[model samples]
Target: MFTTVKELTEQSVKSGLPLSEIMIRSEMDTTQKSRDEIYHRMEKNLEVMEKAVDRGIHEQVRSHSGLTGGDARRLQTYLKSGRSLSGDTLLQAVSMAMATNEVNAAMGIICATPTAGSAGVVPGTLFGLRKRMQPTHDQMVRFLFTAGAFGFIVANNASIAGAAGGCQAEVGSATGMAAAATVELAGGSPEQSADAMAIALGNMLGLVCDPVAGLVEVPCVKRNAIGASTAIVAADIALAGIKSKIPCDEVIDAMYQVGRLMPAALRETAMGGLADTRTGRELKQRIFGGRAQNPAVEEK
Candidate 1:
């Protein structure tokens, strides 16, 4: 168990192994499972993610509340038109990210890379990379392992639950994980992967988790799209030899501290931030028939 990015990178350097292999070995040791077993397990998860991404892109998946749907298809259609100002890869990532979350919102199956709310970023970047990088199947699986390694560190040292640490913990951690994994998949060094994680996470620090109507549809789906875009950019920056002055572990710690200081209303309580706005309250009332006020605090 590498507890921090520094330890993870140091071990990877000392052993001349990719971060994915280290995580695989660690999982084997911890679970007393064979390497093939663990790899196959993660492969199953990859399949689920692939299916969700495909379904979302091809179908108009709408949530029960009808808060979010069809946007992924809209983006894909826009991509097909080739009139986008943003680059194809970035827009593709954003589309896929929204697709996965849209599927999740519609109660479709999705493999949570860290959490279901932030599941899209990893596979979003992975498929986006497929366009140009053309990584093999095994390499794709390793990409997920690399992501899981960083996610493990965040879940253990900081938090991966939005209820505990806000959107910064959920989507922010997933973005960092995806950024590091993206660097590794692109053949960057372990140090470069660490830099990507730090840079990506720093960009998302202190993000609130104020889902409108106590649902994960409104901002959550779009946040995943932005997170994917950020992860790709961060990975490119790291691959370009740009390093974050704040180390990866320290950035994660800072995320933890910020989450700790964040008000409860911003930490998945759905009583503040966008969730507390006049329009947000109106949406809540419409959704729940005017009984959606925070249970612990009566609305004046």
Candidate 2:
């Protein structure tokens, strides 16, 4: 029944329920599944995320194109050294987010928060919050439900597909979801959670899905890491009582419009942006050996 951020927020604020609970109740009502069943399913997803993060950091995961890998391990190593410019917690989340995408690039199994391209943000922030807040397993699971709630709104109202929209819809929506869930995990109000989403997504406007060499390596992995940081900061801002002047739904609408207006080259066609740079093209030619598969653009 809660198809919009406004409706979900009103339901949560009026009923004195957390956004997670609102999402759970909606799941129960629509699917006729008991609360425990839904929670169990979500718990399985959490386990998958945990496994991906662990494996990504533990093992040297390399992509087929050999474009991304080992960066997560390097960051984790720096975090352990205590010499990182960013604190351990932020670096941990960033590393974990990079970890997930590293696994994805290596063709490992990953739970897409909304899309596989933006898979890292939600779990990265949740596990990062765990480092600082020490949330219990139940709290972490509920955090996912909260993320799912916002993700649901984004998928329904806007777009979560890189081809349909861009990286803004993929990573942008995931970052917004993580921000809202982070607000709830930090005990912020549902309204504040909405503001967190708005701020996070607003910061991500106009992001394009221009994968170098038409592969989800290069900038894609790093972007996921940055998305996690952006989500965390956006949550902090919302918890600190900052509000986005534009409403969440309207921001989503604007994103959709921007996506619609985006040049086809920017929407995962890999024919524009960083994908077309001299080094980007060189990297593509190096990796795929002139076999980079960007069907949208005819190869010369």
Candidate 3:
């Protein structure tokens, strides 16, 4: 629970503290904090995401398994070599990762911060942000605060767990959060932030959680990158002042409704979507061996 941006900003003005300092202090003091706890938590999560990006970038070089590792590494190397990675490169990294392996690397990045299963989205978003705009730590914190509010709204109204609300809940929620953050960083108002979130969620509604062989591989990994990209696009559109006909709250409600309509097979059970096919089973056997059993078949 965290105070709204309006409240936090007003309080900062009253206390004669810079808005950024107030945000940082509030983040550091997480115990028994007011509704503003969400802001603190999101900042904490973003810190985690930054660490994860370091790890992910290193992992790409070490394992040589990530999508277009050489290309991404080249871009990363250029950044380390004194050239900054652009937003386009960040977006390409996500797309390449998704195209290379469906496992959600960006979600893996986010899980390093938010949830292990949904790690990639936040980092992907942050990477894009760093590329597009070099905001100060305080600006980043404010952006995160706005994003956290959207995440809180989604959690309060719908669900973020894949099992509970499908992949849409996990990746979709991340996208909405990222989108809102992007909007704020791009100087959009709260209403625009909300609209970006709504658009992101609306586009990803009802996406099934169908990790192959019950692993957060396959579609999960790729989905995270895709989710990140979608969030950016959504935010950019909203920042341009394009309003979504549906409000953010209503979009969250729609997500919940769609989640309810999803079949159990599509809700992280690996019984449907790409997980249930013969190819998926073969891939599972190749990766996990004979111990893997199709839960659907076992139940029957």
Candidate 4:
């Protein structure tokens, strides 16, 4: 019944239980499902995430609009070149994040961690860490539970829908959840996990949901990549003992308020931001033909 980051972290610390355990216990109480059932379901989700990441990186997955495809493979090839400016972990996270979202765009099976648009971040960070940490299968599944814990707080206290709270709610919350889970997986304290979430989410405040052509291609895929990188960095900062001056719950509240102030055009309407750019509009007309020749409907 934890509805805020403060409550979630405090319980984790007091009970001497990992954040993931607390979430599993909470799920048991609420759903009355046996522990094995809940765990097995999450494990299935992990399997789906693994397959999506593998498929996207190994294949040239393209959306129907032809806007985003093969970028994840492209990034992976670059990683193999040994000339990347960023470290392998960061680049791998970015590539994997792009991979998951690209799969979603291509209509491939994907586990939507919070939503399909932001699905990449959680598995991205986890698989990225897998490259360096070598977590066991159980640890990998527990990583998801930890991420779900933070996501639960965000979804209950704020929003996870793009139309309701913009891209900040989608990608932003996903990034925070990934960061917190990364912290726990790295042996950081529950308090540090909360700090990681605050830092990650605060970094993405007010990000708009202006998907071109009202589709989850284009910026959405790239945004998940960036969110994954942000999550990794945020987790590192928290593990280094840095704290967010603004608490995790307050950051979430700020996100909600900012979303409320955002105009409808910026809230997934495809009538503003990159969606309204000349190139964006041109692509829209090309994709939808005469139907998109008309101007976007104004919000009354």
**What is the per-residue lDDT of model 4 for residues 17-43, given as tens digits with 9 covering 90 to 100?**
999999999999999999999999999
Q: Per-residue CA lDDT of candidate 2, range 1-300, in tens?
A: 698999999999999999999999999999999999999999999999999999899999998888999899999888888898878778888999999999999999999998888999888888876869999898999999999999999899899999989999999999999999999989999999999999999999999999998888868899999899999999999999999999999999999999999999999988999999999999988877755355687777
- Model 3 scores worst on lDDT over the 10 consecutive residues at 61-70
Q: List model 3 lDDT by residue over 258-295, tens digit each.
A: 99999999998988999998988777676657652454
Off by over 4 Å in 1: 290-300
Clashing pairs in 4: none
For model 1, the local distance difference test gives 0.94
lDDT of 1 by residue, 24-96 (tens): 9999999999999999999999999999989999997999888898999999999999899888999999999
Model 2 weakest lDDT span, ten residues long: 286-295
Give the lDDT of residue 74 in candidate 4. 98
Clashes of each: 0, 0, 21, 0
Q: Measured by TM-score, how close is model 2 to the native structure?
A: 0.96
Residue 224 miss distance in model 4 (angstroms): 0.2
What is the C-alpha local distance difference test score of each model? 0.94, 0.92, 0.66, 0.94
RMSD of 4: 3.2
Candidate 2's C-alpha runs over 4 A off are 290-300
Q: Report per-prediction Cα RMSD to one decimal.
A: 3.2, 2.9, 6.3, 3.2
Alpha-carbon deviation at 37 in model 1, angstroms? 0.5
